[model samples]
Target: MAELHEQLQQLWSTANKSFRNVAAYGKRNGVKLSPSTVKGWLGGVVPDSTTALTALVEYLETAAERESGWQRLPGGEWAALYRAAHEAKVKARQKTSAPATTPQRASSAPTLQNSTSPAQPGDIEKARRILKAFPLDASWFTSFEHQASFHRIHDSVQDPLYDGQNVLARNYKVRFLDPDLQRQSEKFHDTVNAFLHSLDHMDADGKSGYSQIPTEWRRSFRDQYESLLRKLSGQRDELMTEYGALINLFNERGIPLLPNGS
Candidate 1:
């Protein structure tokens, strides 16, 4: 059995729950995690599988709610936290099981591979692209509009794309079971999600803030919008480059998935 990850241990500690408590919950669900599994998690071993993660998170959340007057974590937040932690675990496994394939960068580099390299760094790109055969024009859904209609592109365009980003990220993580590309998909998903969330707080017509603004605030709004737009474009382009590279790899291997990514 592996040690419990330190953060997992701390979360459990803060909940005042015992390791035995988690095992009990798993036992009820017929999963039956052991005492050493808790140790393993603390000792930096990730959960054996999603099943174990779900069980641990369930126990943690249940205990946390009970300790905090029984207020359950919001379902969405709960899932997000679990997913983020699970991904971190996936990242850790990738590190130990493999090796650093690219020179580590300063603040902004990928935890796995650098995205901005003129070419994909290593064999990971080959594996990353093989999971999906992108449609030539299929990126329409993922593409950001340079010229904004601004009426409700937030609703019609950005939001849907944000949702799609999440779906694609999950498919990479769970379906293809590729953590590296899963991280890239997650980067795109998070940037889109952040952009979407920002839309709710803005005083303008849409995300671009150019809809019908007062002249005084219009300059600042436009500045903010441009900044946001540049990021959106960059993130979108990176993913597209990846998709294009993936397609190239597929062609090289003579095992192209259908253009529709089927």
Candidate 2:
């Protein structure tokens, strides 16, 4: 079976760009992927989070060498590969951690390591630790990796973010977490839209409207651009607080998706 890192290396080799270029592509596409993260993926680290894997795969699709006729695998095939690789890594970890006892004792060992349970405050703390393993910044609202970090914590504690009636939000496309998550996500997309609109408008307008527009009218454009450029410390703090609320709410409601792991 091909490991994910090995497959990533093969894909990287087939692409025309270097790791830094790939990282830059990720940033443009709203993922906070770094060159070091790409290097780590090539160095045998199983991308426990799918966001990084998706970023790399999508990057390769855009960066493929057309002259050489290179093409990435189909989306379905990529999904299969990711599932296989993740399963293989999980199995390997389980095998290595297995006790050296007799067959009977080994069989008696618990198999519910991933069982669901309400996320305790301790689980929240542990999730915070896991979040530390990934990069974070003011741009986290646009970074799917930041969203994935919360999923990791939720998965580890066996908490499902979905409401019972709405399973579609948990899918690859929407990825709905907290209501705040959705709100912030929409806000980020709006900001991106505004930036694009301003870019196109400025390019078309040029100096034609330079002296015609009032001071506030010109500053309105500047304000929109500045909003896009300004630091998002408030948003970041809000997200952090929302994460904590998710855990606390689930814990109080006693509605975890599964029993606590042994």
Candidate 3:
């Protein structure tokens, strides 16, 4: 575990200082992470939630791949080392997070009888009433709106490609080349897929279609989608906000935003 921690720390260190800024960006999204927090995690102070770990991993991966051209390092050594270290860290964290077990069961316990009893008239009537009240139409409409909203955002983001003429062709070309924009495009794709899947099972009962879902199901989905939308909005804003900061850094070192080879 300690060796894994060391490897993770080294991996984090290899990326440029932009990593710190990215960490700060993640913190703004409610991650509460600093570069030091990443250091601590790599040193075996596991993050309390998988969400934190996931955010850290995603930021690091994106930063590293951005810096390293998305190519595997020579001999695939860096990726191999990172994978092993990450697996170990995950296992250790899971062990730490699992609930403690009790040594013994309580003495007083009820036994079940095998005899089957038919449903009472009142119970059958209650179930029928409940099923009659299930919100299938509402679920279907909400799902449709969710899918449509995602598609609209997807199409709007691709508007840059049209450049006033060949919109579809231009958008495709730009997305193929622009990593930042591509990530947003992929996220929109995934959200749309998830929304579709949710709709398929939305009204299912006991894992079947038409089952009553928890009251919070739609609310939770809405919350998570909203959070992701906000993050995407932030990332887009940062392209502008950090442009000056990045330009200044490059200018101080006599480097142009576009290198000579490109």
Candidate 4:
């Protein structure tokens, strides 16, 4: 275990990054742990992935290997350990952060089983958190592990029909929430589009153009990216189950299908 900490320090030195960078890397990869966690990990403290999902644990493990030249240590061996240790914590966090799931709460938030009520503020907040699971950042695509972690989120911010099954705005669409969420949804979609555009433009203009555009884009939107994504994806995925049940209704109706409008 002492050797593990030493190796971690070596990786930090080799990468020329501070402990803060290490912590940020873990959080960005979906673990929600900090530098302190990374420091503890070095001492065999075994950081929690904060959920039962194996992907988050895999991400942090992969990130550790990539950033530091560690040849897979005990941390990689602890998916079960981390999951067991953190499952309670995950439930605890959800219990505290999430809104009540009572009959009235479910109705207010729109449970397809019973209600299609207008989404409340709590629903919005929950969806935003879920959407962060698969953010549109280019940095997210560096590895299959990273990419897989991304797809885990059912996001429809880009095209309501992009995945049809996972749109944040469409999922939370209510008489009261729909208009505002749709508008906010556009911002999320636009950011993703801008990223794709930046990639297209990256080769032609250089990374400089990509960086400049987001500064301008980020300024246009007032909300944080993480928050918005969670709000949208959570409610969206919750609704998709209900939406799928009415495929007959969709096919019965003549939804326009046009390509460039002949």
Candidate 5:
């Protein structure tokens, strides 16, 4: 069966129009839509809200009647597919984040405890939960793929027709910031901020940011972008390691540090 994204792509193909055109059609029908939202769906990011999904389904159903006369998937069927895809993605993440089981020794040997006391029974699972609940990924580079997609889409469509300054029109990078990373906190944030400050210092030939780098500088953009991502990713790894250690410390003491009833 087709996943939500695949079904959306099929609808787009059947519509036979640019995303801008489809969005315009949506506007005509009193449905607010943006090309980037469609692009996000195509990139496997589920629709942000049920209202957006319903508007998209309506737009696709009749967006290309004159050109291809192709009717899109019915609303009920599309909703079912979306729910299945969402559930599948959730299950996959849960499976990935689950803690590994430690093998048991056949011999019941008395182990001498050190002053540092090794992790207790549920510590591994608690650490896993903490890592799973952390807002940022273990690596910033992994999230960079999604950011790169946003930039590419912004570059393609942010012209005279689209108001690039409009927040709704512009597709910004997705940032998964942990609450503990805030300046108010007394931990892992400093290193993260250092990397972020490096990004702030970068000059894209007077352009607004990496996405708007001049055409001539495009050749070096990938290298520059990936280099920064690598540095940030290293910092992210360190942050995750430190966060896991902190979680373990709390877990050992029976302190509830999981994210607000997580």
Candidate 6:
């Protein structure tokens, strides 16, 4: 039992780190996990009796190759250890017996019916456009292991920026491309249109014909438009990068569709 406890302790430490890393990796893959909840797993303070030990074992097994010296644990022995631990903690077991013999009766099993509506012809195109515009690869997102680390980092730093809320927002932005980007782009266009309309209404002398505009106004407009252009350019670049990665992932996995409109 002492040996078991020692092994459990080591396993706990390994699992704590491994689970977080897995969680972080999943986040990078667009999944999000709560930092506080992840911390509980790492701290060995998980409250669920049925899951605590199982979670530790499962995480350790998943991360065994990544963790040093984890390969030394015997598989059968590990299973035995968990079983023994569970038996020691849970005392009562309810026995279930087969039904007694009785006269045969015909019965029918209920069938489930689908209620979902069929997709429209344009749905696929819309989905493709959305995917192309919003890619998932971003530094803010963490994998499973990184998720655990994120929790630790958050706890130590107490930075609200790394909290799950931001992670979730980033996720939603990445996963649903059209609404977020299109909305922003539409707002930008509206602002630019309004500015141009204002310029159109300027007094004849103030509106100096395009070729006769004062040098100062030209420079100011250039600077303002340049800044807006840069912002849009940066957003486009990020979208491309994410889309490219997503395309590669799908291609490698034998997906038939391309991420881009092509």
Point out the worst 10-residue segment of candidate 4 by lDDT.
200-209
lDDT against the true structure, per candidate, is 0.48, 0.42, 0.39, 0.36, 0.47, 0.37
Candidate 4 per-residue lDDT over residues 120-157, each given as its tens digit: 56544444432443332312222322331111221122
- Candidate 6's clash total is 20
lDDT leaderboard ranking: 1, 5, 2, 3, 6, 4
For model 2, residues 1-262, the per-residue Cα lDDT tens digits are 5656667777777776764466466668877455434544565544557886787787686666552666766557766777886676567546533443423455766533222434444444433432232113312323423442121111111111111101211111332233333333334333422322222111111223221112343466767544433323233344455444544444443533232210
How much lDDT does candidate 6 score? 0.37
Worst 10 residues of 5 by lDDT: 160-169
Pairs in steric clash, model 3: 161-170, 161-171, 162-167, 203-210, 204-208, 204-209, 204-210, 204-211, 205-208, 205-211
lDDT of 1 at 133: 29
Model 6 agreement with the true structure over 109-223: per-residue lDDT tens digits: 4232122322233434443443333323323222211432111122222222123222222222222122332233334323322322222111122122221122454466777
Which sequence of candidate numbers ranks them by TM-score, best first? 5, 2, 1, 3, 6, 4
User: How does residue 202 of candidate 2 score in lDDT?
Assistant: 18
TM-score of each: 0.37, 0.37, 0.26, 0.21, 0.41, 0.24
Which segments of model 6 are wrong by more than 4 Å? Answer: 1-8, 12-19, 25-67, 91-262
* Best by the TM-score measure: 5
Q: Point out where model 3 deviates above 4 Å.
A: 1-3, 70-262
Please tell me which model should have the higher TM-score, number 1 or number 3: 1
Question: Which ranges of candidate 4 are over 4 A from the true structure?
Answer: 1-15, 48-262
Q: Supply every candidate's count of residue pairs whose N, Cα or C atoms clash at under 3 angstroms.
A: 13, 1, 10, 11, 0, 20
Better of 1 and 2 by lDDT: 1
Please state the error at residue 228 of candidate 6 in Å. Answer: 40
**Candidate 3 TM-score versus the reference:** 0.26
Better of 1 and 6 by TM-score: 1
Candidate 3 lDDT tens digits, 30-91: 76554334544554443445666666656665677888754323555544555665565566
